[model samples]
Target: MSAYIAQACTIVHKLIDAGHHISDDDLLLAITAGLPHFYDPFLVSIDTLSDSEYTLELIIP
Candidate 1:
């Protein structure tokens, strides 16, 4: 795996081990914390959307 993917997985695993339920908000906070400052505006845009809207925008298949 790439370094970024490995690091992200490690973070999620640590969170899981902490016994807290992992929600979308927790994942988002983790991502925003790791990304560069240039991504802040994009992250803020995501924060403004409803959960359904955010999922739809992701276009997951």
Candidate 2:
């Protein structure tokens, strides 16, 4: 999970460097969307947090 998150962050950073804009919420949503069904519980937990609390720093291990 940590590795996956790292890779996603790397890709996101590259996009940002290339001038693409992506909010942290959208980044997390995209990552969670691609995760397996087994991650549903974790996703549900994440969904309960306020938007301000959602960030790559919190999501990545």
Candidate 3:
């Protein structure tokens, strides 16, 4: 998950350098938004969670 986030940050940084605008919130959303409906329950679970309850290990492990 660290790797995924790192790669996303890398891409986002490039996008910013290229003059496209993206925010941390946007990147966070993009990460989960790319998941298919197969993960709907998991996504919904996270949606209802406090920020501290959400962890990358739950998603990637």
Candidate 4:
């Protein structure tokens, strides 16, 4: 899980450094897409987050 989170962070950092404008919805989709199928339930739960409440904090620590 730590490796997966680290990889996701790296991808996000790279995307930002490359000057691409990624919206939170798109970012979350990308992250979830890369995760294993076992994480589907948790991802589905987060998909309902309001725009202002959406964040990557859950996987950061």
Name the top TM-score candidate.
2
* Candidate lDDT (C-alpha), each: 0.64, 0.85, 0.75, 0.73
Q: List clash counts for every candidate, in order.
A: 0, 0, 0, 0
lDDT tens digits, residue span 1-61, model 2: 7788788888999999999998887788779999999988998999898877877788875
| Tens digit of per-residue lDDT, candidate 4, span 1-61 | 7787667668878998999877666766677788888988987887787866676565343
TM-score of each: 0.52, 0.78, 0.57, 0.60
lDDT score of model 3? 0.75
By the TM-score metric, which is better: model 1 or model 4? 4
Per-residue alpha-carbon lDDT of candidate 3 for residues 3-25, written as tens digits (9 for 90 to 100):
76678778989999999999656
Better structure of 1 and 2 per lDDT: 2
Candidate 1, residues 1-61, lDDT tens digits: the string is: 2475458757878888998677655655565577788867977877887777765226211
Error of 1 at 61 (Å): 9.3
User: Residue 38 of model 1: what lDDT?
Assistant: 86
> Local error of candidate 1 at 25, Å?
1.8
Q: Which regions of candidate 3 are displaced past 4 Å?
A: 35-42, 49-61
